[model samples]
Target chain A: MDAKTFFIYLLVMAGTTYLVRAVPFALVKEKISNPLIKSFLYYIPYAVLTAMTIPAIFTCTGSYISAALGFAAAVILSLLGQGLMTVSMLACLTVFVSELLIR
Target chain B: MHFYKKGLAAGIPIALGYLSVSFTFGIIAVSEGFSWWQAVLISMTCLTSAGQFSGIHTMLIPGAYLDMLLSQFTINIRYSFMSVSLSQKADDRLRGIWRWIFGFFITDEIFAVGVTEDSVSRSYMAGLSTLPYLGWTGGTLLGALFGSILPERIMVALSIAIYGMFVAIVVPELKKNRDVILVVAVAAAASCVMTYVPGLSRLSPGISISIASVVAALVGALIHPVREEAAEDGC
Candidate 1:
């Protein structure tokens, strides 16, 4: 793409992204009172994170076995209260080693 | 100042995670004909993985402008819900211009951290956001400049670290709350069905995730309403 068109594409992409993020913050100034809505919001973080993690995780690495090993390592380390970096690094290491062994 | 420090501390893992993923993005962007600086610019401005990847594909394939716009909107609209949920958690002292300024940084990882906080302040959010922003853009620049230099195995390993980070964030909560387990299970099941089922498998990642989350959360809320007494007790 040319410079002009690239610039326009960036502008539109940035604008749409910012709008989606900003509009809710601008509009929802007051606390939500409804029990159902509040509960739904409360559960969103866990629900979204879970949905994003699974199925996708299995496909992340070259082989499903390596990915599953990484995921299992992650869960165990995290449950042991390791820091995020630690858990991630260890899990990656597990995937690396497991991939080599599997091959 | 204390809260800012805490936020930065909390953000360290997120920044590190971003570094690896955005590095991969940088490699792809450069191969797609973007200059190193252009790829960095995309990361700095967009800060979204799926949307930018899709945007680049649309651009490279000579798609119409409307198609690019629609694809970006569809991929990123989840942020709207996340932002609204976070607005309820932010400290009341955070007002006016700060909201818009900080809202720009409300990516999924940041939103997850922010919503889990007991009380979120503007400075805390700013400190939390700045490092990951730098990591993303900086990693992109490096990746574009040094495309494919890393060994395949190492790159594959680094690529999966972000998922590890996500698991780290959610597993603790899942352990503490039975309701959380239920919500996660429902969402996971819904996502699996949407992903693997014959007809439903055609749904895009964004739409499938959104549907699974909303439906699961709604089911959770109906089945396990937080009683007024329990809510007050926690607060």
Candidate 2:
């Protein structure tokens, strides 16, 4: 991308991102009127993360084997109540090692 | 002072996370025909992983301004939802007027930290954002400068950092909270069904991800029914 064009592009993207984040607070405060709407907001994080992570685990390369290792690793590590750092390192190690062994 | 500490604490993990990922982006952007300053500017200004990823994907495709806008819109529109939800968490004071200042730095990592942290001063939240904001932008500048020199094998290993971070976030939540577990399961099921079943409107990765998340959130709220008192229990 041209230097000038790319810079402008970045500004626009940044502008939109900033607007999206700031706009909500501009209108709404702590007292949300509707309970159902408030309840739905509470669940958004878990749902968004699940949607992102699960398919990613199952659908990477190596057919069933790769998916199996990642899925097994996440479930096992989480079940063991591992901290975030530990679980991620374990998952990354499992995927890396399994990919190497399979190759 | 407390806000400063929280910002520093939150920024450490975030800075660590941004360094490798932004470095990769720097290297890739240079290779993909973006200028070094352009690479740095994009990372600094946008502070989004998927947005830049998709930006480059379409930049390679020989498109016009409209195409660029559409591509960016599709990938990054999810942040709007996150931003709106997070707005609720912001303190209603002079700091509220400065929402735009801190909101610009609202990435997936920042949002996770913001919501999880107990209610604190708005100045602190903004401070929290500033630490990562600087690291994220600064890391990309350095990475764009040094990244082109790294070997392919080493780079691939480093590329796994974001995935590693994702595991860090999700694994812990899944363990302690059944509400979190249910939400994740439902979101996954929704995404899967949407992908496989095929009658629904065609959705991009960004939209699919966002919609599934909202669906899961709505479901979790419906099922668990958070009490006002309970919200303060854990934090």
Candidate 3:
């Protein structure tokens, strides 16, 4: 895409994303009364984060072995109980460096 | 008074996270043949790691428009989850018009920090989000513009940014539960199971991560169910 087209592309994409993000805030800030819904909402981040990160561990290369090892590295470090920053960095380092050395 | 300081504090982690992740995104975009500007647009507009990744993947494939739309929605539906969570955190005093304004900047990291913030005021969350938002956009622009000129080793090191931030967040939380050995055992075992099972081994990273998180969270909540009786009036 050229400069003009790409700019427009970004504008549209950003606009769409912002709209998706912004609309719920406009519509639902006052209506949430049920405690269960509120409680469920609190857990959404954990679900989303896990969903995004764990699978990446196993499936990045369409291979079970590397992904399993990567997942193991992340889980063990995260469980052995580093902070989020440590866990992520260690996992990435382990995966990237391992791949570099092994492959 | 304290708001500005808190905002800056929150922004620091965000800026760190944004710089690393957006830089990676920039590299991915450029390597895929997109222009520097295109990369910036992706970061600025999408403001999401997975969404952008999925978008790039779709762009490479030969597919129907319906398939593209479905894929984007599936990946991005999570943002709506964040929005729902923030609705509970936002104050009743917040006006209708400004509600969406604050919500617009609610990425996963921002939502995480906001929900855990000492106060859930709109100003606090907005202030917290401002730096990360700017850093993310700016970092993407920088990465795209300078990606070629930079040495490969430097770029490689930059990829560690998000992982570093995640470590920072998880480490303290794990430490605080001070002796909640069960979480450690459960989380580790679950991670292993999620990693090795044959049927699950075929799923996408996004779904796998989601399942793992849900399992972990359930384990967490089960271990310490919400003390609704103890919840404060506003909370």
Per-residue accuracy of model 2 over B1-235 as CA lDDT, tens digit each: 7776767787677766676667767777877777778888777777887567556655554434565565455445555556665665665552545765666767777776776655635666666677677776777777678777876434444444444555556656666566677777888898787666676536555556666767777787788866553332211
RMSD of 3: 5.6
**TM of each candidate vs. truth:** 0.81, 0.75, 0.69
Query: B7 in model 2: Cα distance from truth in Å?
Result: 3.0
The collision pairs in model 1 are: none
Model 2, first chain, TM-score of 0.70
Residue-by-residue lDDT tens digits, candidate 1, A1-103: 8887888888888888898888888678776678986677667656766787878889878799999999999999999998767888898899999988998
Per model, state how many residue pairs clash: 0, 3, 22
lDDT of each: 0.79, 0.62, 0.59
- Runs in model 1 deviating more than 4 A are A1-13, B1-10, B28-35, B49-82, B85-93, B108-122, B227-235
Prediction 1 global C-alpha lDDT: 0.79
**Cα lDDT, model 2, residue B133:** 70
TM-score of chain B of each: 0.73, 0.72, 0.70
